[model samples]
Target chain A: MSGSVLYDAPGPRARARNLVLSVVGGLLIVGLVALVAYRLYDKGQFDGAMWDIFNYAGIRENILDGLAATLKVFAMAAALSLVMAVVLCMGRLSDHKPVRWLATGFIELFRSVPLLITIFALWVGIVDAILPVEVNIEPMWALVFGLAIYNSCVQAEVLRAGINAVPTGQREAAYAIGMRKTQVTASILMPQAVRSMMPTIISQLVVTLKDTSLGYIILYPELLQTARLIASNTQVNGDYPYVPTVIVIGTLYIVLCLALSGLANWIERRGRRAKTGIAPTEAKVPEQTGALP
Target chain B: MNVLLDNLDLFREGFVGTVSLTAGSAALAVVLGLIIAGFRVSPVPPLRLFGTVWVTLLRNTPLTLLFLVAFFVVPQVLFPGIDSYLLAVVALGMYTSSYIAEALRSGINTVPLGQAEAARSIGMTFTQTLRIVVLPQATRTALPPLSSFLIALTKNSAIAGAFNNVDLFNIQKVLSNEGYNILVIFIWITIGYLIVTFSISALFRTLERRLEVAR
Candidate 1:
């Protein structure tokens, strides 16, 4: 509140000034929206006929198919990435020096490269070269592997941070109990790490969902690709339905991502409520610094 | 590789385009983000609501969709002369700004309440207090995340290639089409991105150290 210590409560003059400023700001925003609306209207982007293309069964089915493909790729990538994350995290955290270096190199290399290039490389390079001539590598496979590789590195970092966050005392205690290294990691470290890093992990999953759109570049019939095809192919009143198609697609993406985050929030709440195993010791972990979507 | 040497000019142009896209979008994103951050922390409920909505909508949608809208839909409706490169910049800027705003807001929160209180007691206006007292400190905390976001933006800018923007990724595509090894082409593009991203990371590290000393 303005009455908080951050600022003094407004006097009459200050109150009037605040009102004027707010009104001006409000008008500027409204004017900007009106300007965009007017331009769209002038271009016939707001025509009902353009939007009405979605009513067609073929277009609707195409969109649904695209959504399914996108979801399928996302599901595979999400599962593979989590498995890959665990493997990489363990490798990175390995006691052996060569293993640690290999894991670090892999994570850093993939993490630095753009996800699009990774997908492209897998599609054009690895899939072509490694796979037998008889075996067909679908764009879906390329997209899933590409996403899994890149996101596994990211998730590895998140999991590593969470693993490192587990109390040293817990590790010491586990060692004192004569547990093997793998046993300590699997039982003592990983469960607590996953619990602590659940929010960040889920957020990364949201990112993976968003990144699925990149599959469209590799000729994958994902949601964005389908939307583009629809918009380009369909015409209403002699104008392409680019505006309406984009709106629908973008809205779908927004809805899907929001739903994912909402689920994450629910899981986090449930995790907080369940009083199960050993509570993680409170430690101030340094914030992980990286480009997170 | 001989392919890279023979096509130096193509690579140069692509590299330049990628740099321009990254720099232009980063600049626009920072400015837009600052304004949105202002809206977020403003005392007015409506402004706060507007900022929240902007971040929510933009952040949830993928950058590729935004690019499609900007390149295909926006230019058709609003700016006819705008090219794909410019549309890419706009789309990248708009999408990245949401993250920037969130980072700046977090930075702003780290500025102690007493700082604002003291500034206000000294008769400084809210704008003056923010500009002089709050944002300076906020910038220090925000720099690392801002740079990371910019790095991410550089990578995300590759999506422009799909829309006919001849960035580094596009060059890789072209080179591959010309019978060059696809793996080699990808490695080159990957190196270009690494150079850009690492340079950003290094620059921010230096800036952070200098700010630490200043503080």
Candidate 2:
């Protein structure tokens, strides 16, 4: 009888208003969908040839290669970023002030800059300026480095938040037992922080996965870049198939990200039912520090 | 330094462009996010469904992909004559709305049951209870996270720079291509972004502190 937070059950007039409002809202959404369908039809975007371009083996192989490359970069970046985060968070939580400041500054600066710029700069800087005439750096490495740097900063902060979430008494008790600072931090704090913060770290990994699409800007031949190429280079029914290519490629990205998100959710739910004596408080889901794609 | 001084006009244009891009999209995202957050928590099944779909679709896609779609596909097929800048604004804003909605939903979840129950006991309508008792507290709880999203939006605007938007990153491309040092180009552009993002965080922090004091 009383569980709804905002309002009670609707009365007669309220029900009528709600029905009319929903109908209008539903109609508005349906109208939008119809308009999009009509536009696509008129433009011949729904034509068979445009959709059938995927029948080409070469194109499918390109998409698969792109997907593989994307995952490779994600895997490398994910591993490297975790290592970087541990180092940075250790510096951040150190008893020493300068190391803490240095780490904090690094995180803030990189965190504020766009990942696209970082990738582009790395591409140009390494390829054009840094490397010798005979030496070369791959575009894949540029993209990987950028994603790792930016996401590491974010992950480090997430780690810090998790450590902070540990009850202060947990730390004080360790100190009371004459445990050294490093011993308490390593043996006691780090494990609990990582456990409580697993969901957030995985969520940031999703951000890292999506960010690989920025590889397109640097001509890294990732999934989105492959889509751009296929859309621009292919010809079908006198049109470029930009719409179809985007739809297909966008679906791939959505599916991949959703799968990762599903993993995060599973781990989070499992964590909740985890039966530790008195489980450490779960860290808040880290606020997103990067842009939505 | 000379390169920066010589390209001050370009730098200024990019700075202003980023500021406007951020301001426009922030306005749109905040408004749309609030509406979607309403849909998410409303006592109607359809609205809740709609909100979930919107968040999932937007959140799962890449911003660069959205830029490609918004800049290339939509203008070509859906709205033949739409301005590129306008397209960028719409895309960026729409992408951001998902995060904002998520932030606000979490905020709403944090509101005490007693607060809402007390409002209902006073015979407040849903809209009134929400607008008065719920949203203010929600916004308070949501402000810290919301600020991070806005700063991320600023950096994300850099992506728009490559998409025909004359933002800070655009200046980076221009100056770097002009045979200037890449390091110098990055330094200046980075400073410009730091200014905008730092100002945003500061503004949000002050606003949050003000709200705290009032409470």
Candidate 3:
């Protein structure tokens, strides 16, 4: 029904042609899936014993531990990244040209580099080489710092956009009230900016959560790494449990990301409800017009 | 500096590998994304469901997990003779295509209902209208986000380095193992990535400016 505006109702011949195309497409997809499954079965990936490895208590414990470790790193990285985001956002919005340029350069440089390389470099170059042995740098710390560095830059951009979204009249009114620049930004601008951008901020945190899996490259005992260790070390009929391990690990990631997005959606809905609950008609108009530019 | 000079060949090979991997995966992703986007907007119910399900599954899972499946499970079970590089390309392509499809679908939504209605009134078939009038405008608006996705893909192609692929990151890893200065090596690799990503950003910026619709 929604597409009715795009085209006229299909005639008998056109409808028949559409039906044929759909059937063919459906068959092709089914055939492809069947072929892949058959190949997997032939390779013993579907053997009951391949999946039985997860039945062991030790394996379950290992997975839980890995999950916990991943969450731990993510928690630290998320908090630190936000703190750094605030600092970088402020610096980028600084009054001094030199300070702003430096902050901009740092953000752009880190943003452009791949997260994997950043983590690897932090692990091998700075933590291993420069940190004093007495300081005891861990892979966990390296990963945390690396993730924070990249994510903070991204968060700064999001925050900056939110700040820019605030209307010019608000800033002018704050200035007319004899407020200092810092006072205006801190009190008048930032709170409103963060409230408006809360959804974007939360989604970026979801990105950070997924990015924690990248720690596996540096031998961090994260979920994916644990899956790799278990799959390669345990054997069933002379074959590793690669299929089952990947399936489990991938499911865990999917669940975590989906939950995070669900939370984001809930927050966004609550924000919308709060606004419209007060002045339904007034709140709706600005939102519609805000999206125009 | 001397470390870089001495290992120029290794670096060059690694650079070429990175470029090829990014290019291969990006090309595959664009095609798959277009198909998925088509499925999403198609009049058929099942096709729309399939598109929705595919995007949700792929978009939620981490790229590293997909790579693990590709490198460890897929090759052994399905295509035993497939090289690690190709497997990496497939993994990156599949993962990135989900994002690309979402971007394209959003772009299509921006194509005004009036335009489509006009095309239909002029007796254009769905396919003809999409191909001739809709997609061109959709792609023009989608250019910025599509370029961002490609840039992200280039960065992610480094994950392939974790496998046996001799990409830039892998070469840097080998250099560090051979007792090269870690800081210097990291600097060079960072610069390599920066150059590629920035060039992509600049190219897209230019495209966006040139393709701006005249009001």
Candidate 4:
């Protein structure tokens, strides 16, 4: 990439102009870093001594519990949402107008509304009212459900697009073989659609994973909330020890997202190796040769 | 019911604050996003890395945490005397900017190489080609996703209420807890948010259709 860029080397005037922009850009980035650093120093944000507390049995136990709860909720949510996404996609693509309309409305409503609002509403209203017995619908459940609802909508759209993008001839051939609409959709369409839409599905699931942290606001005792509690309770110098906690939690999140990205890249490369469909270059450009004999 | 009805003026004020916060943050986010998007696409290695790291951090972390950190933690720690509302705006603006930046960068990537090559063949500078040819096309490509980001940003601003800010959702929560009609309070809040999100989505749909035709 560097070789190609240098090969198309800029003229002197262009180089000078780019140099000016580069300086300004560098200054801006440095200024942002300085601002964060200044804030940390002035606020005494790094007062937490997590290293010392790391040996404490109680705090360690809580961390383990929190990690379990986080994973449990995330797994349940992702599984539920993927199932919901398939149903919703089918509904949206159905020949029946009512089904399509209902699917569309659901998708629009959940996707438009904030996840926080949905969680709060469901926790306060429906779950609290109907299943107040034998069902402890904690904020954790609310967060997971809310995430599932929103991400399912997004996943549904992705699936619908992928289904549509499949070659029209596949459907025609299936029909000619006397396959019904449902049969065609199940046997032919869904498999191809799933393959094509896997990347977007993984992308939305990564979103779901990150959104698990939102449960902290409603006191879900997720990883983020654990960090916050630990930071507040532990004192190294002074104040609430927010900066170090944030840094720790933020770093954890970065690692998770990068891991997901790596997985996505791997899957994408595998897909390329599989060569599922016609390559773009293989798409013949039509030409008129004056009604070629 | 009557208490809630009578306190409609207070609700309206809160609604205004919510609207203003959404509008202000969206505008700020767009400007910040464009700058970051430019940085990510720039030739400079460190600048590109900065853009990537910024997006990665902001994108992965919860927006609610960012808001709380800005309002409750940051001020208490850094600028001890600063107000929560300004902090909320700054946090939300920065939070939303990261997603918008990603959208715009993807949009820029989708612009055909031929368009820039055509622009430069006539002796246009790289900057000139980008400004005159690339950005306009990228903007059109970005409009749909940008619209969705705006919706997300608006909805997330409800977290301001969590931080004791005088926003619509917070006001409703207060009203509901004060022996006012809880249903009415929530109903109004839902309706208010619905209008904001749906209308913006609708407007964007129209713009998208127009851009499709124009392209």
TM-score per model over all chains: 0.93, 0.93, 0.92, 0.86
Clashing pairs in 3: none
Q: Order candidates by DockQ, high to low.
A: 2, 1, 3, 4
State the weakest 10-residue window (summed lDDT) of model 3 chain B: B192-201
Cα lDDT tens digits, model 1, B87-183, are: 8888999898999998888888888888888898898877788899999899999997788788888888889876888889899888877778776
lDDT of 1 by residue, A1-293 (tens): 23244446778987887788788878888999899889888889888888888888999999999999999999999999999999999999998999999999888888888889889877776555545554455788889999999999988998898898887999999999999998999999999998877777888888999999998889899999999999999878888988888889999999999988777677666666679743332221122233322
The better-scoring model by lDDT among 1 and 3 is 1
- Across residues B29-108, which tens digit of lDDT does each residue of candidate 2 receive? 99999999999888666677799999999999999999999978898888889988899899999999999998998898
Per-residue lDDT tens digits for candidate 3, residues A124-219, read 755556555534557899899999998898888878877887888889999999999989999988887787777777777878888899988999
Candidate 1 interface RMSD (Å): 3.1
Tens-digit lDDT string for candidate 4 (A38-76): 877766554335355656898777777776877787899
Of the pair 3 and 4, which is ahead by TM-score? 3
lDDT value, candidate 3, whole model: 0.83
Task: Give interface RMSD (Å), model 4.
Answer: 11.0
Ten-residue region with minimum lDDT total, candidate 1 chain B:
B41-50
Q: What is the Cα-based TM-score of model 1? A: 0.93
**Error in Å for residue A53 of model 4:** 3.7
* Model 2 segments more than 4 A misplaced: A1-3, A126-135, A168-183, A277-285, A288-293, B213-215
- Interface alpha-carbon RMSD, every candidate: 3.1, 3.6, 6.1, 11.0
Model 1 chain A lDDT-worst window of ten: A279-288
Structure candidate 4, residue pairs in collision: A43-B77
Candidate 2 C-alpha error for residue A79, in Å: 0.8
